[model samples]
Target: MTRVRGTPSPSAPARDDVTSLLRHASLTRFLIARVGSITAQQMLMLAISWHMYDLTSSAWDLGLVGLFQFIPGLATTLLAGHCADRMHRGRMVAICLAAQAVTAALLVVSTATHSVTREVLLGLSLVLGAIRPFQMAGQQALLPMLVPPSLLARSMALSTVVQQISVIAGPALGGVLFAISVVTVYLTSAALFCMSAVMYAFVRYDYIPSPREPVTAESILAGLRFIWRNPLLLGGISLDLFAVLFGGATALLPVYAKEILHVGPQGLGLLRSAPAAGALCVGLILSRRAIGSGVGKKLLIAVAVYGISIAGFGLSRWFPASLLLLAISGGADTISVIVRQTLVQLETPDRMRGRVAAVNTLFIGASNQLGEFESGVTASALGVVGSVVLGGCATILVSLMWSRLFKPLATRDALR
Candidate 1:
């Protein structure tokens, strides 16, 4: 892992420490809504997946849940980014949450009436698919408004902490609630989404609305053009796309659990959470002592470390060693993620943030979804262990190649 340079410089303005940043009411409220909505959304998805599998025991039908969600998101995300820039972003966020809440509420009614089916669930997944791109664009673009520029890095770190915790907790909470009753889980998620929506409505921030640009192909493609023109942004964003696209080690946890480790479903659950747990720990540390100088080098090194960690895991036979390797990989990833996000957000102008964030979000989504598919196909051809090891090596090589290709990203000393 890359070493932390030091604590916040005493001479720096805005008192950019975790406690001071968290003291801001607007930032606090945004975080609360972010965690709430994300958790509820994860729980909602978990319940829906289980519901679909319970109804139809076919693996193909179970797979349609992701396919349904991805198709709509791919189609509408660019448009959603435009909407984020042209509208009250907070209101866009609120509307998205409300829409999700309505979907969950409908599920509760459908489940009660015994009318819920796989088709119904998939259709609702499509609705979620359409709404999330807007929600994500709004949320990313709004955070810069809630804090001073000096504090933005720490704020991003802290936000990552909340996000990792929510990702870990959401599914566990939903699983427990689901064991009691499916409808009960859906009801709770709906209430949480409603709470999140109301909180976002009350949250206030300073935003200078951009003058409405006439809709054109150029307007829609502005984000892409901007990223292409900027080496730093292109390197940071593409690094994630390729690194995650290759280093999808976790997607094969089931094989490790059943065949290699001799553990069952319970162990798979523990294995799945290890990455988030590691990420949460690192995020907490970064929240206080944010990464300082040598930002670009650290970012590259972190990706290399992550790839190495994945390779290490591919060879581990013991459960404890496997868990540690996975944790290390997650921690390394957290470093790269914070650095990339800070650079992307700080370097981009406010007017272009929505569009930039949309492209960023698109790459993130595509990497995750396709990364699993890549893993699956490779596992079939090369065998699971061989696939994972080769992928990790490829990730390391990519990091090396990126250093030469994006010298500005690799040689930079500060995010600002």
Candidate 2:
């Protein structure tokens, strides 16, 4: 097993990495199950949101749907991480998925019987919010178990590809099905959830037992301390938090597409999709060739590139230019995300990965929600373009500041 200390295992034939990855039955099954579950999640989200609107016709309720999910997801982060560390990770994911499946089935029955109501939807949303952190904790912690350290990054890239594709396809599929029948979408999504849960139950991995740490305030907080004590982990995670917090302009896409670019709803869809398209391309490239050296520097550069692209997107008046800028931003973000995740997974010990991952997820979740709020407030004050441009600049500044503040992270030579 002699190899680069912090690099992925020796490179397989470029063509074979993916095949090699697939040949690992556990990883393969998990990936397949992910496609089903994530796609179903997207479909379920769309159906629920649309149904809520149909029932209440209130935009405030639509916003409440997200708020409910976010707050609970945020509130349960530490406990969820503890569970991931203590539990059978894959089975934990299976249970979560199974719960979701039941929820979807209930939705189907309710919709069919005209028994669905806004309150039911909100309550379910609360349940979903609580479930997500547990699922995420288990799923992310489980990946390293299914693959060796060397293959972790490549596997993550491939996983990203699966996610991007699922995110893209799910809504469209759900939309088409919804147009046919709302009940149809729910039933289909429920089936997918059940399939993913069953597949997850069968995906096996070797396990090393972490001490059955007493569930204490200190134990729940251990992951946070572990990350803080490790500079690379802290830098990588915080960099993602701040960079995305400032650079993400997703909330402003509608403003640009509608008023600035004059592109209308059809164009807005394309704008919304530009980043995913870009991320998909980069994820594919990384699946074959991961960042091997100069890991820290590359991560910073990627964040900087993301910032520049966001700034460019903010300034662009042409529809095509906006798309290109957003795509570039997406590609850069994919690199940042992969690098950050790799760092977090590889640097942390197995027993502690769950807690560390939980903390990581919290940073990310906060960034996404706060980023949108920041964008809206700034757009209101600075004008949409000014707000976006300033946010991008702030992102770039964060990258530069982080590079200096976390030199160990910035000068790190490898990801292993």
Q: Rate the local accuracy (lDDT) of all candidates.
A: 0.81, 0.81
For residue 191, give model 2's deviation from the true position in Å. 2.9
* Candidate 2 lDDT over residue span 1-416, tens digit each: 22322223445433346887777788888999999998899788767766775687544465556556667878898898999998888899999999999999999998899989999898888888778888888998888887666678899999988887776667667767865788998999999999999999988875545676788999999999999899988988899889888887765655565578986544655676677778889999999986789988999999999999999998998888888998899889889888889878878888888899899888876676456656767766677789889989999999999989999999998877
Which 10 successive residues of model 1 have the least lDDT summed? 1-10
> What are the RMSDs of all candidates, in order?
5.0, 4.3
- Once fitted onto the true fold, the runs of candidate 2 whose alpha carbons sit more than 4 angstroms away are 1-16, 46-65, 105-124, 181-187, 208-211, 251-272, 315-319, 376-387
TM of each candidate vs. truth = 0.86, 0.84
lDDT, model 1: 0.81
What candidate 1 gets wrong by more than 4 Å, as runs, is 1-12, 48-64, 106-122, 249-269, 314-319, 376-390
Across 1-416, the per-residue lDDT of candidate 1 in tens digits comes to 11112323324576546778777788888899988997898678767765775687433454466557667888778877787788878888999999999999999999999999888988988888788888888888888777767778898999989988876777667767756788988999999999999988877865556787887878878988999999999999999999988987655665676678976544654566677778999999999886889999999999999999899889989999988888888899999999999988888888888889888877776666457657767777788899889989989998999999999999989867
Model 2 error, position 110 (Å): 5.9
